[model samples]
Target chain A: MIRTAISAMLLASAAPALAEIHSVAPGEGAQERLQEALILAEPGDEIVLAAGRYELTDGLSLDVDGVTVRGAGMDGTVLDFTTQAGAGEGLLVTSDNVTLRDFAMENPKGDGIKSKGADNIVYYRIRVTWTRGPHPENGAYAIYPVESTGVLVDGVKVTGASDAGIYVGQSDRITVRNSIAEANVAGIEIENSRNALVEHNIATRNTGGILVFDLPDLPVMGGGNVIVANNLVVANDTANFAPPGNIVAGVRRGTGIMVMANEDVLIENNILSGNPTAPVMVIAYVQPYDDERYNPLPRGVVVGQNTFDGGGYDPQLEGGEMLKAAFGGELPPVMWDGLGSLYVTGDAPGWSLNLTEQGKGLGAAQPAPLAAPAPEAEFDRTGIGAPAELEARLSR
Target chain B: MKFGTASLLAASLLLAGTVIARATPPPEQYVNDAAIMDGGLPRLLSDYGFFADAPAQEPVPEVHPYRLNTPLYSDGADKFRFIYRPAGAQISASGEGLLDIPVGSALIKTFAFGEGKDRRLIETRVLLHRADGWLALPYLWNEEQTDARLAVAGARIDLTTPRGEAISYRVPNKNQCKECHGLDREVVPIGPKARNLSGDWLEQMVAAGHIDRMPQGADRLPLWEHRGKSSVEDAARAYLDVNCAHCHRPGATASNSGLDLRWEQDDARALGIMKRPTAAGRGAGNLLFDVVPGDPDASILLHRMIVNEPGVAMPELGKATVDEEGVEAVRKWIAGMEPR
Candidate 1:
């Protein structure tokens, strides 16, 4: 009886169908194998992968609706693109109602798992990794889902990447649950997405944890997210794990949450303790003045009722004198409030208003040119070797 | 870069380095000052404060007499050991407030002068409901500063929703009011002196037959009815008679934080720091969410219950007892301090 009930629950919870991958044996030619699989894949048809490693030369695109490609396991099946040159989008899935589960797609010259213009394309138990050697000219992303909808990523593990562990962009009705995203420049970043739910996931020991950002001017603005619950969002202590350049210096200093231009996003009931610097950060939303993707808001954000305990360190200072010294000789004060508990929602009146002409609910207007004091042409070689002696000192 | 001699030498050196690294202690590995001084301050205060305020102070005429006239609330069908009765038990600074409160409830014990030098006031514990839920009077006194009080503005109420789910809320005001007052299932409010009846003037009145004896203690005075978290209602009685009876019972600190947590043991109406959270800032709730019924560890109030940091810690006075054992006791008390 117990077995029957368990099976019934599994059946009820299990998605409509299984996603499979086409076989790419070690002895087979990589091009023929992938091309043949792409040709045979129809809408909703799965191509199951057999155990072995296959090296790719050019990028592969699957634009069919409901087409799924799955693998044996991350370590079991390897899509090695070590020798590929100028390849585009390693495993591109651009269709709706599709699913990709249990796979390893590694070291592409371009986006690791890039999917565009699709809906309900779920990726489950997928492991996307990189090779240390020949480190393809560009093996950047682990899993990149852009301009998609209803993307649920569960039990997926990503490792050793220069970019986000899982980057989901401009989608709605998405859920990323029970996954481990660590050791990447940024883990589980949601850019221009709405109504996204991130729960039961361990996003710890990463460069950055769960960021809700809006990349404006690209015709996208994120709003209404639920960073409902999770734990152990600590500092990315690994030195080599730091992002190239000061890609994110101030508001992005090791935050469990980096809240940008968004609204009505609830960050509640999560253990936001422990992180070298801040466990939570609410960055200034100044569009076209500071950041390129700033959508200056009419209202502020909510920093509500969450407990913050330790991992105590904040290099950023509130006093004008301190900020000047930290960011060269003279710079605008980037002091953030509403950190400890119960910060306001929708444009805190306490903070200075940075309203745009359009933000006054006037007719639409062009986004101001990014006034970000131009990024450094050459990113300084990150201190990839110096481990923070301070980080080694903290723990509870 | 080679495959033989140079690589072998580098690998050997790396191995040797690993071995040497393990052999020596890093600078941080050595014992630091923090390791030794952690539980120091909080410990001495608890010990020193306990002794100085023990039946040792000059006896006041009458502290909290309600504990002598009330019956201890027993948990059963109703779930709560007590019930609430508004207007039945009320007190204020003007000395013109309602009395005749039933046993087992918490009430408002506001204090301030109507116009007299008679500074000492009545013990408070019966409860009432208004825009805020059940309000309590929490005023803790340090041994060194008896006149000083750490009163809080908070509300405590019991609400059974239309769905038949009973929810208790304790809205905290400006300060971290939930901390020190929280112990047992109910916040163990500090009495006028030490957390007992020997220090109360009302108990003296009861001893002198001015009022009826509450169903508690060896002499039915309200203190001896202690049974850990179970009989904390009596403890709650002992709490109010001394703490709020002086100030909030009539006149005191602007009713600092505007909360009165004094429920007579006889009345046992749920008191201060017990009610639903209120929205403070623009959509920001003053109470941390996730106060699920039956599970105290997940409650945000429990966090304040165990916390001891300055602005975040409870009582906001005399720093909580920080001995590993004492802190643990506080933690255990808070973890168990869910609405009974």
Candidate 2:
């Protein structure tokens, strides 16, 4: 019995001692060193990338669980993929409980820093830039996390993507806070996901700022239970540079905080300015779909108190001049398609399309002032956002 | 039971004869079975002793050569495949699924380019079936054609394809191998399913006592050389099964897209018939649906295969040039579909 107790104590002390640090420096053979460090790392190990420029030709990946990849700073450590010849992304993380922080990737041929099926992942203080401004040939997304649960993205900056700057798709329990998404097609988009909290972010100079959508024919469906609050969405008047046939390519040039085909979404306490399109728009899915499991209507969407300034002055809608003249120069702060359920907490001025059903053409709409009823009760705040334990990693 | 005993006796006799012939054997002449089961990574490809002559592509005893019915296109480079089985161990097989390779076994494949005299081996990849799981590793060949060293980060080489296009060839890194061989977060072998193997190979293995029995669904995929005799649908389905099904099916990396191109998938909608893309982004390329019936020109699935762009290309790795033959087969199948 005494021997058993001593062995158990030894086992307990061995774990922390086994954790190691693998430091990689940038120079001639940084590609081999950094990639070897990523592949050979063990669980609970840390891989540190020193401050320099890494000229990489191929993509890198990590599949070790509970590993942390850190850099000196987001600006100090740059992974330049200007001459990238292969692979689908700049860096791919396929392991669970991984933390990636303080690194920047420039001019990747595809999406930048994609994490698929990597649960409980944290992406902190990272930057992904296209170098060239908005162009149709830029990579799809800057920071993409898909098909995973418990994702936390904090203090990241992304720019000049043809698609969404920060896109989280087909996942649950996501929190995107204190980030900046600029000069992309759609800034900060949450698609086909659930229980998301997008707060305290700055979204500017894109085609659409802050979109929450539920697309059809995905593995996970019925995206809802989202809260978009305390964000600064302004001046998203850049022309849509997304390649044609993408869903975001159909987005208007100056949209702010748009929610499409979702359920039980709450938009509150945001500052909207310099948006020519409607400051807050809610609508049904416009395209025809064949999936029986899909519901293309926006239901239980509530708009709470928000500040709107200098918006809707030059709306980007069909018959914009006629609508402006009808509304006595400049439309209202909110726009609805009149095919779904919407609630307003106060007297927020808005207009509606007044369409009868889904998949109806815009020509069938009868324009009228919005007459939304007040919300019935308090919105449920349970089981939202990433798990609180993810914050502890940032502190470490 | 008596027949099984007789076959086992004969197998042991054959092994004993081969061992007696190599009395003063050079150390590298035999396979290193311990290296296959060990936990540490071997630094060089020759450390495993898979090849008796590292330059001539010769195999040692108990190493078997195999071929697939329809192979994946890797810029038209020739592939040499081998499987190494330890003494007294057997490979188990089910109907049409992947072969159940036992622990301490390894699969080696070498990719080479050019004709008889100018032939150069670029890289050799191995899949070691260890105790924990299958581990994939890549080794790069040297300029002298002597041996290959382990390259965890992979390398790029400039070469000309068979189609006369000058391009850069990329050898996949250690983790990049998992991008194609991963299922449910575990590394696995993508090729060597029973359906893709020939019936004659299975019979020969069974006779030699290397495998338990003939697989039920053996020799189902159409051969690439004899594709002219097969139907367009058969060839097209075989191409999709070998090239696209690794990541497109459920529980794989691209599972979020909701498209399943596996051979056994029967549902029309699951096979991307008029299915809209969820997150194709710029890869959609002005196309609406993934597959438009009777219109190959409008199908996003065909467009992605034809394009050479990085983000838009299908089978994101291992192919730098378009397969014109594969594209024609898929186009014919799609053109024959009935539009609804």
Top of the candidates by TM-score = 2
Query: Candidate 2, residues B1-340: lDDT per residue as tens digits?
Result: 2243234334434543453344233224378877888987798899999887767676676666677888888887777777877776889987898999998889999887766667788999999999999999999999998999898889888888766788899898999889999998888998899999878777777766778889998889897767888898888888998999999999987898899989888878888998877667778888877888899999989999999988788888898999888899889989989987
Query: Number of clashing pairs, model 2?
Result: 0
Residue B290, model 1: lDDT of 20
RMSD of each: 30.4, 6.0
Worst 10 residues of 1 chain B by lDDT: B73-82
Clashes per candidate, residues 3 or more apart or on different chains: 72, 0
TM-score of each: 0.41, 0.93
Candidate 2 residue lDDT tens string, A104-136: 999888899999999999999999999998988
- Model 1 misplaced regions, further than 4 Å: A1-24, A133-138, A238-253, A286-294, A298-300, A304-307, A314-396, B1-340
Model 1: how far residue A161 lies from native, Å: 3.0
Where in model 2 is the C-alpha error above 4 Å?
A1-18, B1-29
Docking class of 2: medium
> Candidate 2: lDDT of A285?
94
Q: Model 2 misses residue A341 by how many Å?
A: 1.9
Give the per-residue lDDT of model 1 (tens digit) for A205-226: 6656777665443334545444
